[model samples]
Target: MNQTTNTVHQDVEYWLKNIVVGLGLCPFASLPLKENTIRITAFLGTDTEELLGFLEQELTTIEKSDTSQIETTLVAVPNCLHDFYEYNLYFDSIDRLIKINQWEGVFQVASFHPDYQFSGTEPSDRENLTNRSPYPMFHLLREDSLEAALKHFPNPEDIPERNIQCMEKLPEKQVNELFYYLFNKR
Candidate 1:
């Protein structure tokens, strides 16, 4: 079992490494392109102007004389929400602003950082667990109503019926798996 786990871990490590290097680029250079690359952009939702500026700047940053192009994008997420809500919001925000003309490859980028709350600089970049305070990232995935908005919606009598319903917590492994589900490519 441990060996199998090791093999899986190594595979994941390899995949992640590939993502870092491959997706390290963006595709909209309009110049020549390169090899074995998957360009990407990561942006915060609250900053639209800056994100566009950064995207324009990267066009020069990743350009080469070769004819191959890197998949470029203007990724952005909401500043306040940790992951999902911000992710969704930013997607919506840019969905309107994205210029479809003069584009190459995929025009991708969104607010959701997979499991943003748990994915960060720590312990080999592992996902956050359910034992943890519900990550703010979850705010974007879907609101649990009373379970989530209790502090803001303090009118005890005004709670919604959908929120009043209880949800079972996932087991530890399940929680971890959920993080993987959200982050991992399908």
Candidate 2:
């Protein structure tokens, strides 16, 4: 891999390990992560069409790969989607593509960006940090896997609330260190 690709992949992995798994944001993530079943792919393009194409390819790859070998895929786009608004708007197209391809029930995309903010929350809200990442990326997951995990998890519906609480309880120094990307843009 080139230097840029290596850096992007490393950053995504660090965020996954430190922020996502370490903080217990997603309970199911630990197994796939520890088992080395997570795949991280970088897209150095700035165009949405090209990104969509990349997404399509990754989606197909995950669909065909064995779940035991490739449980999930993270498509990191560091060259574009710098603006949260633009990134947020692109989800419509993603949903349409999923519907058009008839993969709605089989696959799903979870978004994480450096500047992710949930509805009804201010940009500085700690709860927004729940979905924030080192860069703009699409987390492609299998519906079957998610359903199975949720079935085994106690009170699966409270995961988001628990994550928000986790973020809210983070020490300032740790937040500044782990989420430097958000402060860098300010």
Candidate 3:
């Protein structure tokens, strides 16, 4: 293979390995489907071009995203304002941008997490959710598959404190499954 091909291969593999090892889950794990399938879409976002630039640069290292293997898509947004994306077009634009960069991932962008412009909601409470001013929630999978291990892995607290609060409600085996799903195959 040529130097360019090797570089792209290494880049894509780097993404896969980081997601699998660093996050304790394969990047592919985020793409789980119902009934032991992979979700095509996963969520990720950043507050500034700094973070987005990092992800984009890393992803660009890959030759292609290979979305054809996925049943759905993996949507990543930059500048996650108001805890989510505001317009479908904006997110869709993100998806397009990913494809344009030569990554072979698949995903459809949605407009959830509205402006959070409601009345009567506590300022502190709302602020808690939006403390960072902008948040990014990943919505992976074509249908609904919360059963997947890629439950709630946002950009923060990923350092593995070993006391994940959500682990309580779930069973031991289920938690293991999640860990394996997210942690294995790095």
Candidate 4:
């Protein structure tokens, strides 16, 4: 792989390990990650159509691959969807694509962006960091695995609240330092 690809993958993995799992933002993530079942693919494209095509290919790959080998997939789009608003707007088309492809229940998409912010929250709110990643990414999770994880997890409804609380307690300096690379362009 090229240097850019290596750097992207490393950044994504670091976020997954440090912020996501390390902070217990997603309690279910650690297991799959430890087992090496999470697939992180980088698509270096700024065009929306090309990114969507890559998303389609990754979805198909997940659908055909063995569940035991690949529990989830993260399509890291470092070039496109840098703007959170544009990234949010693209979800409708993403959902449509899922439904059109008859992957409604079989697969689900979760979004993470560098500037992700919850509705009604200010741009600088610390809670927004919960959904922020090293880059814009479309996280594809298998419904069955998610269901299984949820079944074992107690009070799954409290996850977002808990994550928000955790993020809120973090010092702004630490948060900014950890994610500085995300906001700064190469």
Best by TM-score: 2
Full-model lDDT for every candidate: 0.33, 0.91, 0.35, 0.88
For candidate 2, the per-residue lDDT at 117 reads 91
Q: TM-score, each model?
A: 0.32, 0.95, 0.26, 0.94
Better of 1 and 4 by TM-score: 4
Q: Candidate 3 residues 1-186, lDDT tens each?
A: 122333333433333334233344333343432232322222233344443454454343222333334343333232344332254334554565567765434322323232322334443332222111111323333322222324554543452233223333446575444334223422
lDDT of 1 by residue, 1-186 (tens): 122333433433332343222232111112212333334333333455775465545544444312234333222222434545454565554444334423233233323244443333343233222212211121111112223434554464532222212112335464344345344533
Ten-residue region with minimum lDDT total, candidate 4: 1-10
Query: Model 2: residues >4 Å from true position, as ranges?
Result: 1-3
Q: Quick one: ranking by lDDT, best first? A: 2, 4, 3, 1
Candidate 2: worst-modelled 10 consecutive residues by lDDT = 1-10
The full ranking of all candidates by TM-score, starting with the best, is 2, 4, 1, 3
TM-score of 3: 0.26
Candidate 4 per-residue lDDT, tens place, 1-186, comes to 123778889989999999999999999999989999999999986789988888899999999999778899998888777778899999998998899999999999999988888999998888889988988889999999899999999999999999999988888788777777656757
